[model samples]
Target chain A: MKQENRQRLAGAAAGLVNGLFGGGGGTVLLPVLTRELEGRHAFAVCVAAMLPMCAVSAAAGMWNAPPDLWQAAPCLAGGLLGGILGGLTFGRVPVGLLRKAAGAFMVYGGVRYLL
Target chain B: MKEAILTFLCALVAGTLSAWGVGGGTLLLLALTLLLDVEQRQAQTLNLLFFLPAAGAALFFHRRNGELDTAAVRRTAIPGALAALVGAGAAMLLDVDLLRRPFGLFLLYAGGTLLFSRGKGFSNQRGEEAPPTKKTQ
Candidate 1:
């Protein structure tokens, strides 16, 4: 298949996932690209890719009632920090361990919310 | 040939994760590093770029529904943007493994805060009760 076709297919797939999941596709995409494409291209692709997914999820969350600005602001601030720090911290960190740690955090958060 | 198929599959899965509210960036980064052998920095950068449209769409939808606080978004935009730059700069300065430990700690802190902190809507404001949110008649 052509690259454009592949990308379009990928985008559509991403849109659907975003529609269903809310905000967690990059977790899945980056690895695939990294494994397949490898190197800087994979990294660039991952960043470029999440733009749409995050935009969609945020829009959906705010679709009916906008969240309190004060509340959202801090989170957004964190996100910005996450983006920059995440980018910079990359390569130097032991990502596998980081992944396990992050996963543990998520599990904890999820359990708390569920309970 | 294999790469093309894998990329498509990855995109599809990532999209689903994002839709569910898990924030695809982190997971994608994990996959890149563990499964694909992609470097961390490159993964992070790409993840951010991917988030653009997803975040934008969410913001637009919220705006249309009157959920977006334009003033608030505007207020934080400059500061947040600057912070992002600072974060990026900081990333460049530190050893990523070292940074990861602290970052992980921060996440734990944030999770703890969310789990333990009472709703700040009223308690933090002295003895005053929070104003009841009136439904727009």
Candidate 2:
């Protein structure tokens, strides 16, 4: 398959997983992005790519069963603050360590969800 | 107020990790269900919603840092978005509980790859790969 085609395919799969699973598209997109982009750039770029995917997923989820925004307000507020901090930290961190940490988080998620 | 405070803190942690381009939504879902006793589907929905502004904020910083790849975004966003609709449809059809184990396994596989892949180390957008930590030390 052509490279662009593979990327689009992965993008579709990433979106589907993000939509179906309600996030975690990064885990899927990162591997693909890393091949084309540089290290830290790959991680940052994954977020860029996943943005619209998450939006579509969020909208679809709401359509099926609208959530109370009131319930989400606090989480959003905190997330906004944290996003700023994490973004600031993104460029400074070592990619190798970041990679390992992401892996560890996935491992943790695996265990948490499995139980 | 107490419940709200707890929820905010949990999201703060998740959001921070997420902005780093990792698994913040997973953390948020886990915290909401395990710590706050939220129902699974609701937590999942909340997680999707939570990602938007958080992602926007992170994107701004990444753009400023010159870390974002606009070309890459342009290439992937549309397909990803369309597929998201399909994914959401799938989520709606299945029981939320059933997705957990599969999602869990997926995470483990991805994580293990990340942990051990020995892919290229971190580099700046200028294409300067950072020297190893030991070398720097």
Candidate 3:
């Protein structure tokens, strides 16, 4: 398959997952982008690509139920702050260990949900 | 009041992780539902919104650095949008309890994969997850 086709497929897969799950599309999109482009650009491109996709999905996800802005306020506050920190720290942080830790916790979290 | 603070703290941590590309949105969703007593679907929706500002902030730096590829975004975003509609509808229709199990299994799969995969940098351009034999086109 063409790389473009593969990328589009990745995009669709990512969109579906994020919309259904309410997040996680970037994970689906990243690996494909990494292969298609250089690592730095791939991450940036994936981020850019996800914005619009998430916008559409978020809008849909919120249709049946809207969050109270009061509840959303603090979370958004933290999220915005974290985003700035992470963005600045991007290549600077040693994410390999962090990713592992998060993955381990996610595994634990997943099991907890399961049982 | 306490819950608000807790939610902010959790979102802060999750946001950083996600901004670093570690899939922290999943963590925030779980934290909200299990730890803070938020509804699952609501948590999910919140997670989606949570990503926007975080990603937007990151995009600014990336764009300044000339790291973005507009052509690629064009290729991917359209199909992604259409598929998102299908996924979003299904998510809303399902009860949170029923949704929990499938979502759980997915989490397990993704987390396990992340845990087991070879360690690599966040940017990925540093040389990993690429084919040893294949060349970039």
Error of 2 at B23 (Å): 2.3
Best by TM-score: 3
lDDT of 1 by residue, A1-115 (tens): 6433444344444434333333333333433333333223333444455454445444443442244443333334434434444343333333333334445655453343233
Native-referenced TM-scores of chain A, all candidate models: 0.71, 0.80, 0.90
Q: For model 1, what is the error of residue A111's alpha carbon versus the real structure, in angstroms, after optimal superposition?
A: 17
Q: Judge candidate 2 at residue A35 and give its lDDT.
A: 65
lDDT of 3 by residue, A1-115 (tens): 9777888999999889888888778777876776677667777778788888778877875787788887788888888898888778777766777778877877887888899
Model 3 docking category: medium
Per-residue lDDT of model 1, residues B39-108, tens digit only: 4444444444445533444333333434332332232233333333334444555565654444344334
Residues B32-75 of candidate 2: C-alpha lDDT, one tens digit per residue: 87679877777878888888878889889888877776766767
Span of 10 residues, lowest total lDDT, candidate 1 chain A: A32-41
Candidate 2's docking class is medium
| CAPRI band for model 1 | incorrect
lDDT of 3 at B129: 35
Task: Judge candidate 1 against the unseen true structure and give its global Cα lDDT, from 0 to 1.
Answer: 0.39
| Models ranked on lDDT | 3, 2, 1
lDDT of the candidates, in the order given = 0.39, 0.76, 0.77
Task: Kindly list the per-residue Cα lDDT of model 2 for residues A21-88, writing each as its tens digit.
Answer: 88778768767766666666666777888889988888887777776666789888988998988887
